[model samples]
Target: MVKGAFDGVTVLDFTQGVAGPHASMLLALHGADVIKIEPPEGDWGRALGELKGDHCAHSIAFNRGKRSIALDLKSPDGIAVVKKLAAKADVVMESFRPGVIGRLGFGYEDLKKINPKVVYCSISGFGQTGPYSKRPTVDGLIQAFSGMMVMNKMPDGTPWRQGMIAVDVTTGLYTFQALAPAIMRQFRFGEGCYIDSSLMRAAAAYQGAKLMEWVFSKGNPPVLYMPAGSYKTANGYIMLSAMRPHHFRLLFELIGREDIANDPDLQSHDNRIRNAAKIIKALNETMPQKTTEEWIEILQPKDVFCERVNNYTDYLQHPHVKATGAVDWIEQDGMGALPVANIPGLPRASEHPPQQYAPHIGENGPEILRELSYSAADIDAMLSRGGVRAPAPAVKAAD
Candidate 1:
């Protein structure tokens, strides 16, 4: 078997939701042993979207490549078990409110005492020392707080949150980026570091260019390219980008608007932006005359950048997506067959079967306890006392 980049690293993950779990999942994918510590019930993420037994799409998506062990943090045995794990962990991640993890005695200061070289990461909606740090927040809240909703305004000019958990997922990517460098630093210099990541900051970073544009333009940033936006076709919508003057000319000429294409007032990009209303009106009047596919056939041949606005199904079924192996179908246990998109720069799911498995609540509890050198009786005692939880024994069907 090939060794992974983080083959020998061990991550103690105490994060339940998308952001923290996403970062830990990336670590797991890179060949780290990520031990997910859940509550007695399960990670709250497990209930996100529609539940499939103990897992949901969000949970399955972000928690793959990790072992789960449910523990009651309030219990003495649970705290003891965590401390033991912390002492040996290369990285520790938590997504609790600012002081909640500290109060539970698993804070960076607490863990660093036992393992000076542990890379501790804390994920939250806001930074640790912010005025709004203690305020409860979710992906949508962060989207609203970070100006993403405003930036993603609807056609009717109403601020709108994205259809997906954009902020949470972005936060996870940022968190992983931070962790990778911190781990590298730790490997080089025998030192540990605390990573304070938050959805608010990550969302802002994701819109960094937009924020700068807003500041530079004093809130009225000029349109990027006049003839670049979604337009309704006879049957469906098509998004086009006529970024260059030639492309704009081609688009207009193809759409029977050669007059607009050749107008001196719209030759330069800045001039086009100034006359956006005129260009947009022409497109609106003409684009809907043809179907999205017809428009693609016409515009594409002229070197105009345009594509049919595709939904998930359309994207999944696209010939280019299949030819490139962009998505792989995997038979996820309990979830039936699932289409898992291939992450860039990583091996396909078929190449790493173990990394494709997302654990059920406390699915690896007994095995994890055994590795901690706990006797079978001790494991049972903890389970009975609610300090730990493992999957219930499967009842055999009688023949």
Candidate 2:
């Protein structure tokens, strides 16, 4: 079997919720040995959606191919165990509020003393320094603060948050991109660096183009083009991107609006924008004459840029998606069968099996402790004292 790019790497995941876990999970999917350290109740994500034995949709989705160790971080023994693991880890990722990890004695500065070459990444809502650094943050809050709500405002002028946790997910990807290079630096120059990534920064970066445009236009989008919006078809909506003059002309002609296409008053870009309401009213009345598919069929052949607005089900069952093997089906032990998206350019399904599902809290404690050279008695003692937790011992069949 071929090895993954991160096959020999080990990641110590001290994150919960979306951002930090997502980054570590991406590393795990690429073959990193990621040990997820969770609180005694497990990652809070385990309770996010429907739950089954410390597993939930969010947890399972972001925590595949990793081990879980539930420890009482306040306990001296628990702190020692984490430090021991950090001493040998290749990367450390945490999403604690600023200064919390430092108070816990596992901050990047503290861990660097134990493992100088460890690539440490810290993820938060805001960064480590700033008046708002300590403020609690989630995707919605960041979206509102980052002007994303304004960008997604409804036609009636109501600001709206994006349906998904865009900031958290994007921060995770940004964290991975930052840490991956730091890991390479360790191999190339034996140098490890601390990374500070935040949802605020990621959210801002995600809307970089829009933010710059807002500044340039003094808060309103510039009227540079026409026929660049979504229109309601007979059954559904279709978004059209006819920014160029030729494309706009083609769109008007295809829609059977020859008068609008030939109108001298609407020929210039500024005139078209100034008369947008008239064009929009015409489209709103005419577009609904044909269904979304009918519009796609007609417009696609005419080299017009238009596509039906598809929901998740439509996207999942799309022929092109299946043809590209974009998702994989797997049966997790406790979570049942689920569809997992595959990373592009990687193996569709690696040798990692269903047993690689998200683990119960402290499911791998004993095994991890054993790897740390702890004796059975010590492991039992830690479990007894509530310093560590492991799955119940297997039952033996009576003869």
Candidate 3:
């Protein structure tokens, strides 16, 4: 077997839902052994969205390449098992609210005492301290609070959440970036660090530029460049970004609006922004005369930045996307084929026909317990007492 970047790393993942799970999933993708510890009922994400047997699309998407071990943390024996696993793990991640894991007796402080070099990470809504630290929050609330929703408001001025969970997903990326560095520090200096990551913080970081603009301008982000938004065409909408002077000139020339292109008042960046309304009105009248494809054919050769606004289906079927191998087609049981996206910085050749299915609840409990040196009788006692779970017996097909 070939070794990967994180081949020797073991991760104790006590996270559920998107943010934390996604961070650990990235590590797993790079070859860390991520042991996902869940409740007896499984990660709550397994119950979210459309379901197929024990898993949902949400769970399946974020949990590839991890093993599930359902343990009742309320039980003393279960807590001991978790501590034992933590003792041997290179990284530990949890998404519980502030102090939740500490109450469960497995916070960074506790884990560090046993394993001083453990890279501990905590993901939450408001972070580990503050008046709102204990207040419950999710991705949508973060979007609203961090100015993302306002920045993405409709042209009619009605605020709406971004169609996807942007904050959670971005927070996952931030978490992974933080963890990778912490692991490096441990190797260089024998120091394990505690990371406090929050969706609110990630949202702010993601929208730093827009937030700065809004603050400086004291209003909505001004159109710095004319012809930089979506325009309706005869068949569909096409996004345009003819920001540079030469590109703007080419766009107008392609549309046969050289009068507007040659206007001296529209030449400089400031003048163009000042005349935004006039430039947009001209595009509104002229673009609808041709189809999006026709405009693309005319403008692409001129280097005017433009593309047809693509829905998910169009994106999946795009020739460039396919040629670049940006998605993995995995045949999941019951779910048929799933198009899993390939994360950047990983080998495309090694990404597909996903190495493992999202595990069932308690799917790896027996194997993990055996590694912990528990006897068969000891494992049976823990199972009987509801402290642990073994994978459900596979259903045999009828002869």
Clashes per model (N, Cα, C within 3 A): 0, 0, 0
Candidate 2, superposed: residue stretches over 4 Å from native = 350-356, 392-399
Candidate 1, residues 1-399: lDDT per residue as tens digits? 567889999999999899999999999998999999999888999888887677778888999899999899999989989998999999999999999999999999999999999999999998898699999999998999888888888867799989999999999999999999999999999889999999999999999999999999998767688788998999999998998878888889888998998898999989998988898889899989999999999988878999999999999999999999999887667678788899998898878777888988888999999999999999989989888876753311111
Q: Please provide, for model 3 over 54-136, each residue's C-alpha lDDT reduced to its tens digit, 9 standing for 90 to 100.
A: 77888888898888899999997789799889999999999987888999999999999999999999999988998999999
Q: What RMSD value applies to candidate 1?
A: 2.3
User: Residue 331, candidate 1: how far off, in angstroms?
Assistant: 1.4
Alpha-carbon shift of residue 23 in model 1 (angstroms): 0.5
lDDT of every model, 2 decimals: 0.90, 0.85, 0.86
The worst-scoring run of ten residues by lDDT in candidate 3 lies at: 390-399
Every model's TM-score? 0.96, 0.93, 0.94
Which tens-of-lDDT digit does each residue in 144-166 have in candidate 2?
Answer: 99999988888788999998888
Worst 10 residues of 1 by lDDT: 390-399
